[model samples]
Target: MRRLPLAILAIALLVAGCDDAGASPAAQGSTAPAASAGGACQLLDFGMVNAKLGLDLSVAAGASLDNTFTCVLQAKGVSYPDLVLAVSSTTIDADVFGDMIQPKNATAVQGLGVAGYQMPTPAAGKAGPGVEVGWLAGNKRIIELSLRFAPGTPDQRAADAVPKVVELAKLIDLSSL
Candidate 1:
């Protein structure tokens, strides 16, 4: 039985090797099936500190059937004065996803603020920096990307991540999604 399994594994490896040799150069270079419009938005490395977040790309329902990509990042135990690198485009916008982030050291809650449908406060906990990119869909269905790291203080990380995120966002091609 052991010998039979070994033989099967060997055969499988040989078949996989043959398939690779038959694949075209384009097939190896491009992972996606077809070319997308927005181009390709590559995910770069961003060093953040104790950060957690989500990236989602989905097809919008109704009307034109647009595609949207949202990136959210949150971190704890961050110091003061942070920077964030984010992506930028007319269709891309960055903002506080939920309620204002009341760090460990908060003075007071002055006033209420507008809330988004996907992000409601109270249960939402403290708000984190978020970037959203969207565009009309053509050949692609969805494109999602994210980068997380423990850079340091929240303020500093946010500031640094902003520009980087914007640059990254511009690289994203909605047509591929």
Candidate 2:
């Protein structure tokens, strides 16, 4: 019985390996992909991220569809900043942010980019620890770097993550778009 399942599994693995997938997801060298429509984000090189964040990062995988392009960066398979970062274009203007209900510790930040802000987790009780930094590139686009820590994470650590994400946002070159 065990041999039967092993044979079936082996055949499935062999078939998957033979599938004609597209080119490897790794971005070649430092050249970035072209900006998508509506003009919100540009493909960023891993070295650029490492230089900005002071950590070695490499692309784990990527995809491009129409006006959107996304590349995931990781260090030894770990997510960048141990969380998530998104630098992409959107049709909506920055004024949409005016409707946001600021969390307990959201603070307006100046000059991380055209404009920026940091949002920290609430100070009390049990809530997921998260921090986000949002930056505006004029009115047509906004870039955000965010991190979510394990529940019950120390408030100070959540507070600290916000600044680091803001630093990462500053590295993006909006003019290149």
Candidate 3:
């Protein structure tokens, strides 16, 4: 369960490098890992996304990175070129992790089917960092919105990723999974 953040980090690096791609104000980036049965969960398709968010996802071929429940979208005029929407029925319970970040900075979400928070992740290069917004729903299902931009980008662009995650979280229904 402890490996959850590293796994998330690996994904972030992938997203940073266009490689691949948790929650809680539990610390901005901290997450409590729980065990859950995999393979049974359902991932939302691109059609489920709201076009108004500027995330133009299509049901084109190879759009999905992980066939089971992961969709990767290519960015157009958007600030971030790599956007990943991933849904999972993770066993890790987020409630047990305490608070990842101070409640002040963490945005308390309501009616989103779960307790969600947004955390900014810092990177080594010039691109700055990306924000990961995640929530726990139903039993142990976790829905995460990971957004990464090109390296050495401006800090404002990195900071802009937070609100986007929250907006997308509302559009997704974790219970359906």
Best by TM-score: 3
lDDT per prediction? 0.25, 0.46, 0.47
Consecutive 10-residue window with the lowest summed lDDT within model 3: 21-30
Could you give me the TM-score of model 2 versus the true structure?
0.53
lDDT digits (tens) for residues 1-177 of candidate 1: 111232223323322232212221122223342112121212221221122222221111011111222222222222111112112222212232222222222222111111111111111122244322222222322222223333332544444554444344343332133
RMSD of 3: 10.4
Model 2: runs farther than 4 Å from truth?
1-42, 64-68, 79-83, 91-93, 101-105, 112-115, 121-130, 148-158, 173-177
**Residue pairs with clashing backbones, model 2:** 40-89
Top-down TM-score ranking: 3, 2, 1
What would the per-residue lDDT of candidate 2 be over residues 24-71, giving only the tens digit for each residue?
A: 233434434323211122445555555555555433333433433333
Overall local distance difference test of candidate 2: 0.46
Q: Which of candidates 1 and 3 is the stronger one according to lDDT?
A: 3
What are the per-model C-alpha RMSD values against the true structure?
A: 18.0, 12.5, 10.4
lDDT of 3 by residue, 1-177 (tens): 122453354345434443212210111111221111122112433334424245543321112224224434443333344556555545555564225421335555666555776666666554446666666666565556666666776657767757766766776654354
Q: Please tell me which model should have the higher TM-score, number 2 or number 3.
A: 3
Comparing candidate 2 with candidate 3, which one achieves the higher lDDT?
3
